[model samples]
Target: MKQNILTGVLLAVIALLVALPWFAPYFYIFVFTEILILGLFAVSFNLIFGFTGMLSFGHAAYFGMGAYTTAMLLLHLDWPLLYTLVAAMALSGLLALVIGFFCVRLSEVYFAMLTLAFGMMVFTIAHSWRDVTNGSDGIAGFRISEFGLGLDLVMGNPAVYYHVTLAIVVIAALVLYVISRSSFGLILKAIRQNPERVAFCGLNVRSYRLASFVIAGIFAGLAGALMAPFLRVASPELMHWSLSAEPVLMSILGGTGYFMGPFVGAALFVLLETWITSYTGAWMLFLGIVLALMVMFFRKGVLGTFLDWWMNKND
Candidate 1:
């Protein structure tokens, strides 16, 4: 069928991307790693913002939790990469569950504000807890050891790490896609469209929202886990409100309604940043102008607008 062909083509494209390091320049591998990690983070944020109709300004709380968990595990325990990542997910998920229980009680702007408050609290702890977290200096000099698949991995090789990141990100993205297509995802969508109607229909809308929140948190944590090792540090900046905005911007730029939109948006964002920064120091100013234009004209986002045009043309 036509759908199967399209799916195959998409898979082929992704396969090529995963193997890009083999063909592209060394610097590009680093850029691609950033794109993959940030793309996953954006997708996780979209689960709540796009599907559940919840705007959480504090989502970085989970991201930071994951990074800190992984960093501490690697720094103190010297745990293997797999174990560290698992711990990161567990810690982040627990935090999301606790925060989401309270957050889901409110709606719209109140929910965003409450999440933002919780996020700042997490950032404050990371910044002030000098004894444990190393305070503002962050946890650095962390290294990745054996990958635990019976293959000895050279921890210092950027190319190898890039491949590992690609594998993890692809798996996480696939899992998210499956979840988004499931019955639970449908219920969440319904709740988003009309929470009162969903509640009247015997569904616990709050619980569903919490579940989605927790799921998103776990994935965000995974992104954080990747980032910790990639960046060679885990600090309070991971928990900062500005860090939380990355996913929001990606989702808005890519189109929250489409599954691949955030990923596409992330790729564009990183590439643009890299190119623009090389040309001028005023990259932020340029980004601000571009984002403003996006908000004013391309409200549906790049992917959303493109999809709309394609669908309409076919019709």
Candidate 2:
């Protein structure tokens, strides 16, 4: 009975969150969209970092690929939003398959470095390919068309876009959550703890890791596809190493142990950026200081620490 009440309350809260843009100010609607997209990105990163015990520094490669794919589709083909997003996921998944095939052969720091190198290679291509990529300027002036599914959404309205983004993000998060709770996810946890043991049990540990990597890439690509339209441009910066750090930071802030931790962390991060940037241009300095404190004192992350305390108190 108590658990049912708790579940109901949680669902109610989620309902309110989904409806926030309808009541909140216009600027806040944009902020919510950003939080949703980045939260999904962070969650995808956590699948590898938290569950698989792998630290990838080049995750932005798939993200950038998604962004570029969506941008190109919108620019050249002008496909509907749904079709473009599908293309983005496909492109990112293919890239992840190739990259993961190589990276999964290695372990620890070497794997990270190898992924970083490949990511930088992609970044370089986006930066130097003047004819197709438009050099560093990226693809611009693209517009969203019909949303498909028989829903007639006004492309120019931010509110409509926000709802669409919110819906897709929620569905994606749910899919990830289901994956995390499955038998396959338990196998992943086993592999993370002891790959040798998992292999001894006749499990294909490398294949499992590759599967997680590709799924994470697909989710990240979805975030990137949404981002291109939000920003009205897709540039080399989307593929840069700095952009890759965004998800890592959010995961650390939110607590990687919990599925919704990155989403919470992304909200805080985006809100802080919005508030702080209005006061001064030294936001990065403040962010650096906060991150240092988080590393030193709250290694499990904000949600992780809070949940720990709550559980301990109840016990």
Candidate 3:
């Protein structure tokens, strides 16, 4: 009964999020759009980290690949937005497949190290490939054309773009949520709990891990594809290790145990940055302090700990 109530509340919150742009201040629409993209990115990261227990330090490689893929298509090929997005997902998924094939062969720290290595390799290619990637300047001057779906989509309008991002993100989140609740998800969790035991049960642990990694990359690519036009650039910075860390931080902030934690964490993260940067130049320092406290005290994460308390209190 209590679980039902909590679920209802969560659904209401999502409803509120869906309607946020209608009533929120104009600037807030942009902010929430960013939150949605980063939230999806963090959620994708959590799939392998929380469910599969494989911490990837190179997740941003997929993000950057998706961003660049979409950007390049828009710039040189004059591709439709929908097709660009599809290309982004395909490219990112392929990269994840290659990376995961090697990374999943290892375990624990070895897996992380391999991911980081591959991630750096990706970053280097983006940085040094001046001929195609436009060097440090990245891709620009690519105006967003028709969405090619015969639908009116004004990419220049922030509110309209926000709505577009919201719609796509919600759809992706729903798909990811469904997958998380499936038997495949249960097997991933089982593998996380004990890979040896799962292998003993005749499961190919590495294969499962690889599949999850590819799925994660596909969604991360979606987020990246959305982000390209929003940011108006797909720089090497998107592929940086620092970008990879954003999802990790968001996952930690929200609590890895829960599916919706990353979204909450992304909101908190963007809100905090916006609020803190307005007050002080050392926003990162303040963020670090708050994050340290979150780890020290609310070890379960902002949403995780809050939900834990709420459920306990209701009990």
1-315: candidate 3 lDDT, tens digit per residue = 878998899789878977887799988998999999999999999999999999999999999999999999999988878899999999999999999999999999999999999999999999999998987899877868878689888878888888788888888999999999999999999999999999999999989999999999999998999999999999999999889999999998999999999998899999999988999999999988987887789899998899888878946
lDDT of each: 0.90, 0.89, 0.92
Give the per-residue lDDT of model 2 (tens digit) for 1-315.
544864687689679877887799989989988999999999998998888878888899888888999999998988998999999999999999999999998888998888889889989999999899998899998888888787889966988898889889989999999999999888878878999999999988899999999999999999999999998998999889878888888998989888888998898899988888888899989877876787578778887887777667756
By the TM-score metric, which is better: model 2 or model 3? 3
As for model 2, its CA RMSD to the true structure in angstroms is 1.4
Residues 1-315 of candidate 1 have per-residue lDDT tens digits of 545865887799788987797899989998999999999999999999988899999989998899999999898888888789999999999999999999999999999999999999999999999999999999997777776667788867888898888889889999999999999988888888999999999988888999999999999999999899989999999999998898999998989988888998898889889988999999999978877787678779997897687667756
TM-score of each: 0.97, 0.96, 0.97
Off by over 4 Å in 2: 1-9
Look at candidate 3 and give me any clashing residue pairs: none
Which has the higher TM-score value, candidate number 1 or candidate number 3? 3
Q: What is the lDDT of residue 276 in candidate 3?
A: 89
lDDT of 3 at 220: 92
Q: Positional deviation of 40 in candidate 1, in angstroms?
A: 0.8
lDDT of 2 at 50: 81
